[model samples]
Target: MGLLAVPQPYDFERSLDRFTFWGVDRANVWYEGGLHRVVDGREVRITPAEGGVEVEPFDEAIAPVVRKLLGLEFDLPPFFAFAQRDPVLADAVRLLPGFRPPLAPDPFEALVSSITAQQVSLHSAYAVRSRFIDRFGVAFEHAVAFPTRERVARAEEQELTALGFSRRKAEYVLGIARADLDFDELDTLPDDEVEARLTSLRGLGEWSADWFLARHLARPHAWPAGDLGLRKAVLAFYPDVTDVRAAGVRFDPFQNLSAHYLLAALRYR
Candidate 1:
C-alpha cells in the first residue's frame, strides 16, 4: 500500500465548515501558532519533522478508505446559500474561511468526551479532558487514545476524582463505560430516539444532548438553543428579541451549518 501526504496549515479561521472539526472550541483552534496534526490511518503518522509536517503513507492499500473517512476529498457548493440571508452572518462567513468537521475514530469515546464538556467553560472542559486522558487514556504512538468501556468500566470514582472529575461526573462516566454500549444501535433509529437515549443519561439535559448530537453525529438541524454564546450571538443580530428561542426561527432549514458559519464569519474579528 502507498500513502498520500497533504499538509494543511492548521488554521480554522475560515474553515470550520469541515465535518471533522469536533471537540475543539472555535477560539482554541484559531489561537496563533497552533497546528492540528491529524493522522489518517494507523499506517499513516503525521509527524512534524524539523522541516515541516511529514505525511508518511505506509501500507498504501487502505489509502482510499482513509481519505474518505478523514474527509480529504469533498465538493463544496460554490456558495452556501444559507450564508446569504443575514447581512451580519454573511459578513462573518466571508471573513472566515470554510472548514470540515474533525471527528474521532471511536464514536463512544467522542460521546463521553462531549458529555464531560457540558455546562462548563471551554478552559475547564479542556483541562478535564486532558487530565482524563492522562489518567484513563492510553498512548497509541502520538495520539492519546481514549480508553474503551471494557477498560474504564471498573474505574473508581476516587480515581477519576484524582484525575479532576467531580464525584457526580465520575459516577456518570463510569456508568456508561460499564454498560458495554457502543451506542451504534441507536444510530438507525430516528433522531428523537437518539435524543431520548442520550438525554436519559443522568446529568445530561436536552441542551447537552443537543450539543453532543450536533458536533459528534453531525445532525443537520441542531442549534445549541440553550447555549449562552448562541443566545448572545442570536441576540447580537436581533437586539429587539425578548425571546431568543424564536430568533432561531430565522435559521429553519440551515440551523446545523449556521453556528460554524456564524462563528467563522465572526471569528477573526
Candidate 2:
C-alpha cells in the first residue's frame, strides 16, 4: 500500500461523488467504501486516509494518474477566499468543507463521457456508458478500463447503437475515435483554440469542448454553462441571473471550481 499526500481541506469521499452521481459508473467503481479504478493497466483500490488517500497494490509510476484522479493539483485556498465574498458560495463552503472537484484522468474517457451525457438524463447516460464500457473496455478485478480510441475506432456504428447510443452519437463517438487529431497537442493549445478545434469536428460542440477543458485538462476558467444541472444550480442560488453562461464571467479565474461547488451543493441539498 502507498499513501498519497493530499492538500489540506480535501474531502476524499465527496470529491469522488461525481463518479457515482448518475449511478454505477463502470470506470470508477465505488465498492465497500473504497474506490476501485484502473491505474496503468492495474486495478487499485483507494480509500480515504489521513491527510490523503491510501492505494493498495500501488505502483510508483501510476502515482501521477492517481493524483489526477483525486484532483490534487487544484488549489482550493484561493477558491475558499473567493467563496467568502459570495453569500451562496460561503454557505456552500461551510456546509461542504474540504470539497474538491475531481477530474476524469483520461482525456478520451472525458470526452466520451461528455458525449454520452449529451441531451440525456445522467442516469440514462450512465446506463449507456456502462454498457459501452462493458462491451469494449478491458475488465480488471474491480474496475473496467475505458475503451481505447483504437478499440472504438474499429467498432461498427450498428454495434454502438446496439449498446444504446443514438445513431448520431455513435457516429460522433466513432468520428472522434477515428479522427487524425492528436489529443496530446490539445493540452498545449489555448482554451479558445481547443474549443475551435474540437467544435470543428462533426458532433462536438461548445458544451463538450467546455467540459473537456474543465474535466480533462483541468483548465481553471472552463465553465460548462450549457449544462442543465449547472443552470438549475445557479438559479437556485442566484435566481436573478438569467443567462448562466453570461453569469460565468463573475466566477472569473475560478469558474470551473465555482461551477463544481455549486453543483455539488445542489446535489447534496
Candidate 3:
C-alpha cells in the first residue's frame, strides 16, 4: 500500500462525480469511501490524499492502469489556457477546474461499454450493464473485474438478453470479444487507422469508433461529433453553434478534452 501524488489542480470530488455520474454499481466499481479497482489480479484502493491520491497495495503492475485511469499523462494547463478563447469552454473549465478526462483502463472494456450504451438512455445502459457485469464478471473485495473477452465471447445470446441486452447488442458484444483483433495494438495506430480498424468490426460504427478514440485511446483530437449529449451540451452552452460538429472544429487537437469538459459541465449543471 502506498500513496500516489496526482498532479496539481486535481479535484477528487469532481473527478469522482464524473466517474459515478452514470450510477453506482459495485459490480464494476465501488466508491462509497474511496475508489476501488481490481486490476491484473490485484485489488487496489484509492482515496484522497493531501497532494494527490493514496493507493493501497500499490505495485508496478497497477501503475500504468492508474496513470491512464486518472489521465496522468495529460497536462491541463494548456487546455485551460486554450479554453479562455471560448466563453462556453472557459465557463466549463472554471466550473470544473482540475477535472481530467477519465480513460477506460482496458480498450476491450471500453468497446463493451460502447456497445452497451448504443441507442439507450445512459440510465438504462447503466442498469443493464450492471446486471451483465454482476452476472458474468469475477468478483473482488468491493468490485468486479469486467468480464473477460473469452468469457464474453462464449456468452450465450439468450443469457445476454436475459441480462437486458438486445439480441443485436449481444451479438455485437460476442463479435467484439471473439474477433482476432489485438486490442492492445490499437494504441499504436494512427487516429484514422484506429477508426478504420474499429469500424471494420461488425456492430461498431462511427459512434463506437469515435468513443474508442476519445475514451480508450485518449487521442487529444478525437471528437464524437454525433454524440447526442455533446450536441445538447454544446447547444445549451453555445447557442450560436447550430452545428455542433462544425463548431467542434475550432477546438482541433483538444476537442476530445473539450468534449469531456462540456459533458462534465452539463452533468454538474
Candidate 4:
C-alpha cells in the first residue's frame, strides 16, 4: 500500500461523503470506510490513514488519477483565509473544517454525470445513472468504469431512454457522444471559450459548462450561479444576495471552492 498525503486540515471521510451510498455509485464505491474504484484497469481501495489515505495495490501510474479523484491537490489555506472575512463563509468553514470537494476525474464521465443530473432530483438522477452504468459501463468487482463516449455514441436514443433518460436528454446525450468536440483539449481553453464551445452543443447549456469548469477542470473561478442548489445555498447564507451569479464576484479567486464549501455545508450540516 502507498499513502497519498492530502493537504493538512483534510477530513478524508467527510470529503468523500458524497459517495456514501455505495450502491448507487457506479464509478466509485465508498463503503466500510474505504473507497474503491478501477484505476488503469485495476481495482484499488483507498482508506483513511494518519496524514491522508492509503491506497492498496497502488501503482505509481495511477497516483495522479487518484489524487484528481479525491481532490487532494487543492490548497485550502488561502481559501480558508478568504472565508474569514465573511461571517457566513466563516461559519461554514468552522462547521466543516477539513472538507475537500470530490471531483470527476474523467472529462467524459464528468459531462455525462452532469447530463444525468439536469432537471432531476439527485436521488432520481442517481437511480437512472446507476441503471445506465449497469447497462453501458464496464463492471469491476466493486466499481464500474463509466461507458466510453464511443460506446454511448453507438447507442441508439431508444436504448438510453430505456435506461430512464427523457427523450430530449437521451438525444442530447447521444449528440454529445457523437459531437466532434475533443474533450481533452477543453482544459487548454480559457473559461469563457470552454463555456462557449460547450454551450454551443445541443444539450449542454451554461449551467453544465460552468460545472464542467468547476468539477472537471478545477478552475479556481468557476461558479455555477445558474444552479438552483447553489442559488438556494447563497440565499440561505446571504439573504441580501438575490443574484447568485453576480454575487459570485465576492468569492473572487476562490469562487469554485466557495461554492463547494457552501454546498457541502448544506449537505453535511
Give the alpha-carbon lDDT of every model. Answer: 0.56, 0.90, 0.84, 0.88
Candidate 3 lDDT, tens digit per residue, 146-193? 889998888889999998999999999999999999999998999999
Q: State which candidate, 2 or 4, has the greater lDDT.
A: 2
**Top candidate by TM-score:** 2
lDDT of 2 at 183: 90
User: Per-residue lDDT for 84-183 in model 1, tens only?
Assistant: 7677767765565435434333456666666677777656777777667657655444455456677788788898888777888888888778664447
Rank candidates, lDDT, best first: 2, 4, 3, 1
As a TM-score, model 3 comes out at 0.96
Give candidate 1's TM-score.
0.74
Give per-residue CA lDDT, model 2, range 1-269, as digits (tens): 99988887777888888788777899899989999998788888999888888898777777888888888878899888998989998888988888888888888898899899999999999999999999999999889999999999999999999999999999999999999899989999999999999999888999999999998899999999998989999999999998899999898989998988999899887
Model 3 spans > 4 angstroms off: none
- Angstrom error at residue 213, model 3: 0.7
TM-score of each: 0.74, 0.97, 0.96, 0.96
The residue pairs that clash in candidate 2, if any, are none
lDDT value, residue 237 of candidate 4: 86
